[model samples]
Target chain A: MIETKDLRFRYSDTLPFVLEGLNVTIKRGSFVAILGHNGSGKSTFAKHLNAILLPSGGKVLVDGMDTVDEDRLYDIRQHVGMVFQNPDNQIVATLVEEDVAFGPENLGVPQKEIRVRVDEALRAVGMYDFRDRATYQLSGGQKQRVAIAGIIAMRPRCVVLDEPTAMLDPVGRREVMRAIHDMNRTLGITVVLITHHMNEAVDADRVLVIDHGKLLLDGTPREVFSQAETLYRADLAVPQPVELIYALRRDGVDIPGDVLTVDECAEALYHLLKSRTNTRG
Target chain B: MLKDISLGQYIPGTSVIHRMDPRLKIVLTLAYIVVLFMAKGPLSYGLVLLTLGLIIVLSRIGVRFVLRSVRPLLFIILFTAVLNMFHVDGDVLWSWWILKITRQGIETAIYMALRIAMLISGTFVLLNYTTSPIMLTDGIEQLLGPLKRIHVPVHELAMMMTIALRFIPTLIEETDKIMSAQKARGADFETGNVIRRAKALIPMLVPLFVSAFRRADELAVAMECRCYRGSEGRTRLRTLKLQGLDYVAIAIAAVLAAGIITLGVVLP
Candidate 1:
């Protein structure tokens, strides 16, 4: 669990605030996605969850431990893991299993336990088969999965991923998203995903849309995306399915506007066509 | 094409030598070097060569692969041998203008070349070809643990080395990408004099440096998020424990060193 209270941050005294008087809370075992355009401070917010970047003006508490407390830094980090965007940069080891073990090792876990955690984490990410493979030899999806495994090996209660799938291909994105969801569901770990991808946020229990260092919209995928005009004004787009529903509605097709997934969109269209056929018959 | 260059000389295997504790291997390699330099005569050199031969065979890495490690240094070895052969004055077996090919000179040349070659081949087979780079750094870190009392940042240095080794291939891939991008934009890297070619690299180097710095920054944050706060209170997954094979290897190294030293004194 993470709680941020009017959190504000700036890189330096001269620079303007990147995050300004923003408040957000991430519940334990919940999947939350923060959506924003580039430089909208979503990553800055993710970093705050794990104390990678301490708030300049307000408080960030990881399960009741303050991020500003120097002594609880490792404790806070262990409770909330952060996965960065670049798979190549985040992996500290040359080998897959070794990199996964890095986080557990840093936490001072016993050698045997570290091994167990590494294997378990790799398996959770569907990368158990590639445990001994060289990190560079892996595909983009596999590498991102390995990065996720590295974080979960520490057995953190929460994970904050900053645009993890931004650099990945479509297939790689799917692979990483599946791994993230597996951790959230099977492992019961809280997941805070930061991304600009509308589809990535579509499945989240809650989506917080950020704009210019402030919370612009906060609701479920359907609620956040239904306000398509506002999201567009913030230089963001709805998921393609939601966009399609909105487009049809604009053409006076009288369709539901809450479709967030392709399946839902297809079902709506199918029912609409079936009703039309019945009327004609 | 650059990706084909193996970053480290390690050839992965499950051979006895590969399974040896890297700390013991490092110590034995150092001891072997000492004995190698102490070698004086043909008998001593022969013993040294025999020890290296035994290690190469035990490594299961093949003699050819072990010898390949010596290829890059062939020029230096030949240069040293030639210098020693011409400079050493002894019984002249042949005469040239100012260069006399003496029996002792020839013997010295052969011994010098043999020592250098065996030295490299022994380490390559015993250490590089067997131990992974991570294990090698781990061994160095533990071996230098005592130096921490003297205010040495041994863990940090080893950590830096480990990270550097990890990023080498990634950086190489980036370099390949940058080179291709430049080539696509009509940047000529192939044809020119040495200086011209060097100048052409400026474009590639600038972006490479920028990207490398960005990666470094992101990596630091990632490492911090993983709770990596230097080596303090850290545990390792693969702890270096000496096994029976390691002790046997150590005993062999000790015997080889003592035998070579004794042979040098006895035969001299």
Candidate 2:
């Protein structure tokens, strides 16, 4: 589990705080989506999780290890992997397999075992076939998957992705989302995904919304998306189907606003229409 | 036009030279260059030219392509040839005001041009046309690995080199995109005076620099997150090992250099 206590941070003494007095807890092996707009401090919060940035006035503890402890810096990082935006920038090596081997090689893993981990990580991300290909030649989505493979090759207990799909196209976005979901479900690796995309957060076990450097909301996807006004105040929008249901409920249609997916919305509408016709008969 | 710069361009092949270890290739290329400078008289030059020609043919990197590699150096060759043609004093063949051409001048000019051309093509054949840049850097790092005893940071330098090579194409593509965008905005990069045009590039440079710095920061964080401390206990996927072909290539280079030096003493 990861926990932050009264987390506070700012760039300098004179600047306004980017994050202030924030506290949250994340369970082990759970997929959580951090929701926020640009400059809402989501990325800053994610950085503090792995001790990439220490809080100015608070503390972060990852799995009972204090992030501020100097000796446990590498220990904390090894447990929490990070994948950043810009797939082109995060890739360190020219070759796919070599990039995947980077993390393990850094940890002093044996040469033979490093190969095994690299192959496994590539397979996990569904990029084993392109193991020998040059990384620069790959599409954005494939490159992002290779980055994920690099992180997983270290065999971390948790992974944090900071807007990993923001630079990708629609197809690439879906491909990356699929890989993240697979990593969470199959490997049971705790995932902290930082994204503003509403649809991407729908499947997450929990969602934490940040607004003006404060935790504005925290709940499951269904519970969180139900609060349309709060998301509006945060400069965010509800998922499409939830928006539709909210509009219907405003028109006195008695539809629930908790629907997070299109299929659920369709099923609820089908039942609503059926009841109305039976009452007329 | 910028894309025409052929840097570290490796053409994959199955030639005997291509199959040699990259370290051996580098050492041999340096030896061949030293010998080319030592060569003198018609006999040594003839032997050096004959050897280079045979190696070119054997490497299978066509004569036309090798000559094309020399195309960019045309200006330097012309300058050297022209300077040599009129500088050497001997029996005058032609004289006009400050310019004088002699028989010895003509001979020296021809020899100088041939020497420069042979030097460039020899290095190109070994470095650019055959061995890949990654292999070259790997060989360099291995050759310099012992310098770490003196605290030289060999691994860090090699890693930086590899990363730089990897990002060149990416940065080029980015520059192309930024240029087109600026052009579409009627930024007028072409029709301005030198200073004005350079100032016009400020817009492009600013964004590129910003992105570059951002990329460097994020890459540092990502690398640290991956447990990269230094070269302390790091291992590599591809290890450099010298083969029998490498030994033979080195031997050939040594023999050629010794022959050239010996011929320099005996001839003329």
After superposition, candidate 2 runs with Cα above 4 Å error: A14-16, B1-7, B89-100, B192-196
**Model 2 TM-score, 2 decimals:** 0.92
Candidate 1 scores an iRMS of 0.7
The per-residue C-alpha lDDT of model 1 at residue B265 equals: 76
Q: RMSD of each candidate?
A: 1.7, 2.5
Tell me the lDDT of candidate 1. Answer: 0.90
TM-score of every candidate: 0.96, 0.92
Tens digits of per-residue lDDT for model 2 on A1-281?
A: 89999999998999999998899999989999999999999999999999999999888999999999989998899899999989988888878898899999898888889999999999999999999887877899999999999999999989999999999999999989999999998999999999999999999999999988999999999899999878988899889999889889988997766788999999999999999999999
What DockQ class does candidate 2 belong to? medium
Stretches of candidate 1 off by over 4 Å are A277-281
| Model 2 lDDT per residue over B4-78, tens place | 332356877889878878887887888788888888888889889887986798789999889988999999998
| Predicted model with the maximum lDDT | 1
Q: Model 2 scores what on Cα lDDT? A: 0.89
